[model samples]
Target: MQILEEKTLGIKSWSPEDRPREKLILKGRASLSDAELIAILLGTGTATMSAVDLAKRILLCADNNINRLAQLTVKDLVKIKGVGEAKAISIIAALELGRRRKSSDADKPAITSSKLAFDVLKSDLTDIPHEEFWIMLLNRGNRVVKKQKISLGGVSGTVADPKIIFKLALDELASGIILAHNHPSGNLEASVADLDLTRKLKEGARLLDIQILDHLIIAEDRYFSFADEGLL
Candidate 1:
């Protein structure tokens, strides 16, 4: 097999219609393949490899799984040939920007179901290396007022203070809230501490006339909903 150099294999070599960036501009982002989307962000590769080829190699490192991009770190990315510091930073930044954009778009609409709630919070929470407690404050109409990270803690951390969780909600005059936390181990199962914390929050919310809509335990690619499982 013959080796194709970067310049020969690059999007620059393709007709404008075939280039990922040009195609995206003409046809929209949804028209691009995962590799094509990634290649556009990568910009270029080393002299020996095209950006698209490098993107394919990077995706293959994650088992050709686009979703696994969330799991990649800058260190992991730099291990790839042709992915120097600048390219690695660009790739990671692009992925994070996409994640933030998706979250913002998804959160624009009111979360009406457990599934929708899970979808909005999973990406933000599940990959967190440490425990984070997020309070999703909702208006009387059940539309989200805001989602705030109330606290960050260590492994096996516990945050059971209803006052801490509800202070912001009360300040915003929120009628309801969802409690969300992540299990860094990627197990969606709720621990005893999780159950206890939810129960306490429910009681506190009830006393304050604020509804506890749900408690979501987020993990990679999966989540546990207290309301969905009849635990709340």
Candidate 2:
């Protein structure tokens, strides 16, 4: 009879070097593949699948794109056969920690250019299915005082309420503001509503004595900056 390495044998029967946790400890984190790292987070597997095998299935759902995998909701993960709520939560927590670390590492203390703005914002906006509007409230020196979410919507677009925006800026005592939103379709072009909103906000900012410094349309890993294009 052929030797069975799967089923009840599980990862325990595998050679230490082949096990994700043991490999991570022996070989260091850099030596582990993406699936291996995820397998460690999963901790255990189903009756039919090993932890590594189950993690591979999860990666397949994201098409092996780490960015897309980070975007998955807890509900999206639990739908997978072997992933329970606890395992799904662990995966989400690990991804979120990595994301926050990345954002902090890319931090720009001041808002001097659109490129810097994009660098700071892309961590929050990229690799997601929905559209979200956000703003950076800046002081007189163009230093970021606060970053706030304005609204969220479906894949096509989101709404930004001028009244709420104005209230936030005024309450923060911001002297300038930068508007940004994501395009889940990966199209960076500003739609008509985007243009109209920009115009209205510019006029409102003028009345409030606040400078409308820039508007950015983020898509995927790239960004479209209105001020850079002389659209402001």
Candidate 3:
């Protein structure tokens, strides 16, 4: 049914089966779309809008990117017509909890697989509106020694100096390192720049006898791994 655009009646006036809260109870949480789940968080909307209508507008503010939505600040959220400070805080709090839960799921100390590396970093980098380069230092067994940020840049690209990356790895006495960087546009394809940088870093690490295990392009929910794809 048509239910939005800030002109729908209040959620309470809708059929009980159609309300977000009731839908969750009846159909299970997985059945609701992201907007509907957020509507449940909002609780109510403005005089002219249903809760789902307000939630859709909030999602629109982030271009309907849940990852990007998680990044919006309270000050940024309250700027929306129907979003007050309390509602803004609620949105931020819920997203933060999700982030923490993802991070908490990283139970292994070793970065044994590309999926593991993605799990380790996605909580912080996924859906961000900027690019960032990070390196994971690994011991001989591929257990993580530390994760270091190399650089942060705009939406399109970020720079990672091989010197700085190696220096940190060397300092940690790392035997191998995995390269990671986020693509805010949610594109997992390795750009020309991404390939060039990976080649350069691989050669540099080879000279230092430190293995470049993989270079991952971390987009939103997935990643492109050079090693996994045999590009390394």
Candidate 4:
């Protein structure tokens, strides 16, 4: 096995024209291959392969499924042939840091309307494989106080009790809330269960004085707002 030293098998091995970093600099990040993009994070590899090769192997382990990357734990990364503790920790830390950064950015704006609520939750909920019910907690002014996942299950069968929903709102001291759920089938239309749940929640919220602002059904790149349809 050829050991990959910083000088030998690292970025130094690639000619100026063939180097990923240089190519990214000359062109753009969009121009880089997936292996190159991952290799930049990996930094280096073991004796048997370069970082790019290691990245290719990692993607292969994911069966080329990008979402599978989210499922990977530190132990899973370390189990890969060339990924040691340092590399595994670095990768996991990078992923987590990115998630926190996105969440922080998402948390900045208050969700006043159904449109605003959808904007805040869409990015996270759109790609989910299963149905996830989330509550967007809002202050008296309608700015977002926090967002919390209330439950998860299949599309038509997911059940989220009003008590469970209200508990989090009470805990957060939220004056208003938005209910959001995803359709795994990529259909934004509300099911009968969706409408029933929304009606039930709105009735419950009215009694508790916690306003139900909207019920949004999210699919890929599309969404249905009950409020927009005068259903709220």
Q: Evaluate all candidate structures by whole-model CA lDDT and list the values in order.
A: 0.81, 0.91, 0.88, 0.79
Candidate 2 lDDT, 39-109, residue by residue in tens: 99999998888898999999999999988898899999999888999999999999999888876733357
- Candidate 3, residue 162: lDDT: 92
Which structure is stronger by lDDT: 1 or 3? 3
Query: Candidate 3 lDDT, tens digit per residue, 107-173?
Result: 4577888888887877767757899999888899888788888999999999999989999999999
Kindly list the per-residue Cα lDDT of model 4 for residues 73-101, writing each as its tens digit.
77888888998888778766776675556
What's the lDDT for residue 153 in model 1?
A: 84
Q: Candidate 3: where are CA atoms >4 Å away?
A: 1-68, 71-76, 104-106
Best by lDDT: 2
- RMSD list, candidates in order: 3.3, 2.8, 5.3, 5.7
TM-score of each: 0.86, 0.85, 0.71, 0.69
- Compose the digit string of candidate 1's lDDT tens values, residues 15-95: 997888899999998998888888888887667777778889989898997667667888988887778888778878887
Model 1: weakest 10-residue lDDT segment is 4-13
Ranking by lDDT: 2, 3, 1, 4
What is the TM-score (0 to 1) of candidate 1? Answer: 0.86
* TM-score attained by model 3: 0.71
In candidate 1, how many clashes are counted?
0
